[model samples]
Target: MNKLLEGKRLLITGAARGLGLDFARRACAAGARVVMADILDELVTEEARALAEQGHDATAVRLDLADPDAIDAVAKFAGETLGAVDGLVNCGAIATGIGGPDMCELELDTWDRVATVNVRGTWLMSRAMVPYLAASGRGRIVNIASDTALWGAPRLMAYVASKGAVISMSRSMARELGPKNICVNTLCPGLTLCEATEYVPQDRHDLYVNGRAIAREQVPEDVTGSVLYLLSDLAGFVTGQTLPVNGGFVFN
Candidate 1:
């Protein structure tokens, strides 16, 4: 709405639904040409088509972060399509159905799976985009993390560890990418109400709601503003930092 990202080229992952898709739409509305990548190819294509019908510059690409080849392909496709990726939102990860076991009960395969998708995927994607971002001369990277790591949420060992890795990686990335004028930051949201979170137990949801100072459920929209700001020039000087967008449920 503010045209904050006018003429910027953006690549957003996990954009078939939830927070990633919202960020893509918001970025488009803010005057950025976006390439939305997701593992759900057909669904993402449809979403991009809908955005196109509304006169927004949007393209959808298939991205399966589990496969290194897929990640490379998507990044190449986005760079070619966007013509110079000014920003990237690494919002894709294994979030659903990966928790519920305590760390002691968590299987090594499960832990490896979460790390491969969430941690490795974020790192590879960011590496693939460095060239284009450096070319933009003011690139931004917003890695979507979770507040569960900060609060030490129980029975979610793998998810929490993966997000913790993301938070740590962002800071390192900011320092490394800073020389290229690329800002890298992390956004840690609390248990947000999204399709991916529908499997969360009612008791857990209640705990988050009651614990937040805001005393309300967090929706996908609640986080889009902070995400967009990080991708915009307004946050050019803001990097190597983590902001908890969880309504005071856990202050960072």
Candidate 2:
């Protein structure tokens, strides 16, 4: 809102809908040019076009995190389209319908799939984008982890495990990328009311609301502010940090 990101160029993954979409919109509104990448090609394209109509610099490209080659291509396209990347929001993951199966009941394939998309995907995407970020001189990387990783939510071991890995990876990346002036951090969000979380049982949602210090259902906005700050100059000195924005549901 304060043009904090003016002239910044960013790449946001999983931006077709949900929190990723909101991040893209808020970044654009804050005066940044962005490339929105997702597996939902058509929807991301439409969303980017709408942002363009609103006088924002935005573009859409399909990115399948499961494919390393696809990740490389999208990284290339985003750098080309934006001319340079000042920040990357790694918000894409296999979150929908990946619940219900307990650790013992969870199939091996399901675990692999979640790791492939959530863990490996985040790593690869970050790997692909580091160059553009290095060129920016003041780059930022925001990896979207989950509060479930901290709380150890049951019956969702794969997703929870992958998010934990993300948090660990971000810390390592911060250490490795610090010399390059790129800040890497992780945001652990609570059970947000989004399209992806629609399958989560109402009982679990109630549990989150009741346990939260704020005593309200989490939304995309609750987490987006942390994202903005991490990507802003104010947070340039901060890296390898984990911020849990789950209404005090869990502390780091």
lDDT of 2 by residue, 25-123 (tens): 999999999999999999999999999999999999999999999999999998888876899999999853534866778888888999999999999
- Give the per-residue Cα lDDT of candidate 1 at 210: 96
Collision pairs in model 1? none
> Candidate 1, residue 119: CA error in Å?
0.2
Query: How far in Å is the alpha carbon of 71 misplaced in model 1?
Result: 1.0
Which lDDT tens digits does candidate 1 get at residues 1-252? 479889999999999998888899999999999999999999999999999999999999999998999988988998889877899999999863534777778889988998999999999999999998998899999999999989888888888989999999999999999999999999999888887888889899899999999999999989999998998878889999999999999987
Whole-structure CA lDDT of model 2? 0.92
Q: Lowest summed lDDT over 10 consecutive residues: which window, candidate 2?
A: 95-104
lDDT of 1: 0.92
Clashes of 2: 0
How far residue 149's Cα lies from its native spot in candidate 2, in Å, is: 0.4
Clash pairs, model 2 backbone: none
Please report the TM-score between candidate 2 and the true structure: 0.98
In angstroms, give how far residue 172 of model 2 lies from its true place: 0.6
